[model samples]
Target: MAKKKSNVVNLDERKEAKAKASSGNSMMVSIMNMTKRIEELKTEKQKICEMAARTILKALDAKDKYTYGHSMRVTYFSMVLGKELGLNDQEMYDLQLSALFHDIGKIGTPDAVLNKPTRLSDEEFKIMKKHPTESYEILKGFSVFEKVARFAKHHHERYDGRGYPDGLKGEQIPLYSRIILIADTFDAMTSTRVYRKGLPYQTAYDELNEFSGSQFDPELVVKFIRGMKKEQAKKEDKFYIPLMDEMYEKDAA
Candidate 1:
């Protein structure tokens, strides 16, 4: 409590000092100081925003561990493709958030539907399809994730416009959504589950290639495959997640 009060008092003093500095050189220095302080505040705000993001992800993790791990791998794969496509730093950051939250809506799904070992029935599939929109609903509430929510909401939309929620066609879907779908599908295909073994990387790549122009974005699919080949060359069994500040194992874990 005392430290908090002291910080408030220090901020008041700085404001007062700025108001008092009227001389040309003093005013310039005050302006510079204010700019630096503004930058610091922005950094602090971003950290807080990231904390909120991590907290929400923890909720998702607690609800279902498999989904949480899947989300992480999706983010890593999306980032690999993001790099291959030459995404700028800011673009990559937004893509990461989009991938992490893409399946967040699944938390609202029934446990039976989420954890079923076999293929979903037509009725259960309908329930499963609601997740992307649910993801949008949850994430849109956060002011910082406005764009990310939109991206997540459309991650399942197909290139041929046969997907759900909005039925958006090619180039109509957000680019991050396109990139995320590729990653999401890749992880789903390659991640091991209780009912069956995960497909080999080469098999997954072939599936991706076969569906490139229909389910996945044609160009991004190519870039993702190229980037994944480089990832395989590294032979690293783990990948890093920036938001969680932790390392996670690759597929078949």
Candidate 2:
């Protein structure tokens, strides 16, 4: 009877140990599954955000063809400076999106103010100046676009404390914003319009240099000019924008 009882106790101990090992293995598998699921969710969220960005860009295209093309050019120009600045991959990505969306708020402006061929009146200029704030409003709602929104909002700020909508000065402005502003002004000066011929690249460079430290960041202006000179030397007829999957001629009008 004693021997039989001991055998029963040993069997119970073995069964308990096996059960514990099985529970531990199950827990490990659950943890691994959760980790994989988390990674997948992150990828899915990124895709959704990208999709949203594309949709908004398309809407801008439909609203203003000129602005759409300008956005593409601005993005290209910003990337040139971004490369010269030795930005990391993620910084480059963020810079591209911020530049592309910087003028997106113009979509909400009245056509008279937005599409006027002549110089704007004070009222019209006031309306036009609201675009950066409008851009912030449009973009700040998205979790993925929070940083991009801030960059867009501050793109109009000057190196001096003279700019509008908050007047953030010098390095107080986001670096990406400062970079985009240079690119924006460059594109505006160099892009051909019905009323005026585009300035030569050198002429535009001179203009940027003239305003350095007053209207623009002095260091960034130098880097932008250097980078752009290299781009011009490439002598490539067409440049491709990866975000929109489109190609633009080097001197697109």
Candidate 3:
């Protein structure tokens, strides 16, 4: 066989390899910059969606006084109480969303029943009771908030299986639902409806105490009580009574 020429370079090939390595490093830098830019855009998109969602909620608030501020107060209480109970951030987020939507089913209720200055008739109340299920149906379609759907649907359930849409008793109820239930009841009791007056904080606390084990989770109630005590000690945490009264008075007027 005839000798073939060795076309491969020695030092020249090493220099070319070094050049390629530096080019690859530049390409990697470019890729990182692009990745960061994409993340920023994604973050901006999330902010926009969040703003839009809040705007929708605000619009809903304007249409319904009973719903508007009540939802926000429940959300704040639920989230703070959940955090005090040592729930994780994601769980707390779900609790807030659930609390905010717990009364959404009432949107399906007629204004006569929902905004009635007098006590609801049995039939009207029965129709009003369907709100939780209505809320669940409305929210379940949003797969992103499926967890919240359960919370809204079951918040009305009683610890002793007395409360409603479903008769789930005791531990059968989801903890998140149970949490919102406590918050919802607390806010509802402290807030005057068209047919009733707001209870004093002491009265509300006593009511919650009286209802424990039957109406609420005893352990959660204990945590709630402790949280309330701590909150009451803070100057900014004193909104439970005044805020409810003012809002409800406005509603009544």
Candidate 4:
């Protein structure tokens, strides 16, 4: 009888040990599954954001073809400057989106004012200047675009505090905004149109230098000129914009 009782007790101890081990394994599997699910959700969110961005670009394309192309070129130019500044991957991504959408508010501008070949009158210019704020209004509602929207809204701000809208100045201006401003102005000066020939690269560089510290950030202007000169030396006809996932020829600009 004593031997039989000892045998029963050993069996119970073995069974309890096995049960504890099984429960631990099950808990580990659950934890791994939860981690994988979290990664999948993050990927899904990023895809949704990219889809929304493409849709907005399509709308801008329908509204104005020239502005659409201009936005693309601005994005490319901004990336070049971002590289010169040694920005990280995430920083470059944000700057690219900000530049691409900087003039998105122009979609709401009157066609007459947007396409006018000549200079805008004071009143028309006032309406045109409202585009930055309009960009903010359109983008502020989207949580994913919070920073990009703010950068676009302040792209027109001058370094000397004389610019329109919020009038943010100098270092107070967002760094990405300052970079976009340089790219925007460069594209505008260098892009050829039916009415006027694009300025020579040197001429454009000189203009940027002349207005530095007032209309533009002086350090950025220097960096831009240096980077662009190197880019020109490369003489690469084709350029790729990562955000758009497309390649464009320099001549197309």
Candidate 5:
């Protein structure tokens, strides 16, 4: 009878151990499933954010075709400098956003000032100069655009503390902002506008050299010029913007 009891006890112990093992396996599966779901949620959120971003960009495009195209070129030029500076993936991404939206405030600009074929009056210029601050206001409203907004706001800031909206001087300006200003001026110089013919790339380079250390950071100016030369050597007449997923002509059309 004692031997019989021992055999029964061993069988019950085995059953208990098997049940515990099965429960542990079930718990592990549940955890993995939860983790996967969380990752999927994150991807979905990112897609939604991108969709919203594209929508805002389309609105900007509808507001001003010239500014839209100018922004694209600026993005390309900024990326050239960014690559030359060896920015990591995250920095490059942020730089691209900053450059692309640097002039987004122009969406609020009146057609009279934005598309005028003549030089702006001081009053009109004042209205025009409000763009950088306006850009900050628009972009800062989006959670993903924090750095982008700040950089755009400060892009017009001069190294000598003479820029409008803000007097941030030298390195007080975000590095990305400093880079965007160079690209912005470069595009403005190279793009043919209704007001006047575009300057030659060589002439633009000379102009940039003339203002270095006053309007631009001297070191960044050198990097931008060097990067642009390499870009020209590639002999490609078009550049790509990852956000728009589009290629644009190097020269103004």
Candidate 6:
């Protein structure tokens, strides 16, 4: 009887050991599967981000000829202004992104109105005002562009609340939007359109100052103008006419 009991006990011990070994293997397999899934998710996330950015750029390029590549240039200029204005990294990033999509709503505007050789008519002007709302609606699905969409919605909002869409006057409008507003306007003024020649830098600068009180945030306009002057001082040898010509050509095409 004692010998039989010992044999049974040994058998039970073997079973327990086997069970533990099996559990360990299962745990390892589970961990490996989880790790692989995480990697796959990361790859998919990156792909989606790339796709979204590309879609935005393509949409902008198709919106208008002159405005084609202007988003990125405005983004670069806004980043410079954001940095000079003491914005943090995240704030600067937001400004850059907002500037990139500031006119994304123009995607919904008719090409006739967008590319017209003459100024927009009152009826056309009314259509133009819908861009902010249209952009907001179009971008609502994208988490990446949510803040940028908000900025886009309000980029034209005047400091005094006269601007369209939300009309969120002054500080009520996001600071990032404010920065983009100045940057976008500056770039537009300096770049020619179908109906008009580009304003000279000095003339554009003066116009900015002239509109500071009503059209722009007074403090931000100062910062933007200062940054422009500093950039000009650094690139004094470059005529910039070629750059302007290329920019307008890209848009006109």
TM-score versus the correct structure, for each prediction:
0.86, 0.88, 0.74, 0.86, 0.85, 0.74
TM-score for candidate 2, residues paired by index:
0.88
> What lDDT is reached at residue 25 by model 1?
71
Give a tens-digit lDDT track for model 3, residues 1-253: 1223333454577889999999999999999999999999876764564454455556667668777777767776776688788988767766767887777767667777877777788999899899889878877766555787888899889999998988999999999889888888888788876667887667878898999999999999888878877776774633432212332221222
How would the candidate models be sorted by lDDT, starting from the highest? Answer: 1, 2, 5, 4, 3, 6
Q: Which stretches of candidate 6 lie over 4 Å from their true place?
A: 1-47, 236-253
Over 4 Å off, model 3: 1-56, 193-196, 237-253
lDDT of each: 0.91, 0.91, 0.76, 0.88, 0.90, 0.74
Instruction: Estimate, for each residue in 1-253, the C-alpha lDDT of model 2 and write its tens digit.
Output: 9999999999999999999999999999999999999999987886687788678778888887789888889999999999999999999999998999999888789988888999999999999999999988888877778999999999999999799779999999999999999999998999988888899999999999999999999999999999999999998878888877789865647
Clashing pairs for predicted structure model 6, backbone only: 65-251, 66-251
Clashing pairs in 3: none
Which ranges of candidate 1 are over 4 A from the true structure?
Answer: 1-35
Best by TM-score: 2
lDDT of 6 at 128: 86
Residue range 116-191, candidate 1, lDDT tens digits: 9888999999999999999999888877789999999999999999987899999999999999999999998998
Where in model 4 is the C-alpha error above 4 Å? Answer: 1-36
Report the error of model 1 at residue 130, Å: 1.2
lDDT of 5 at 141: 80
Residue pairs in clash, model 5: none
Greater-TM-score candidate between 2 and 6: 2
Q: CA shift at 160, candidate 3, in angstroms?
A: 0.8
Per-residue lDDT, model 1, residue 23, is 65
Model 5, 1-253: lDDT tens digits are: 9999999999999999999999999999999999999989876875676677667767888978888889889999999999999999989989988898889888889999988888899999999999999989988887778888899999999999999677989999899999999999999998898768899999999999999999999999999999999988999988898877899999985
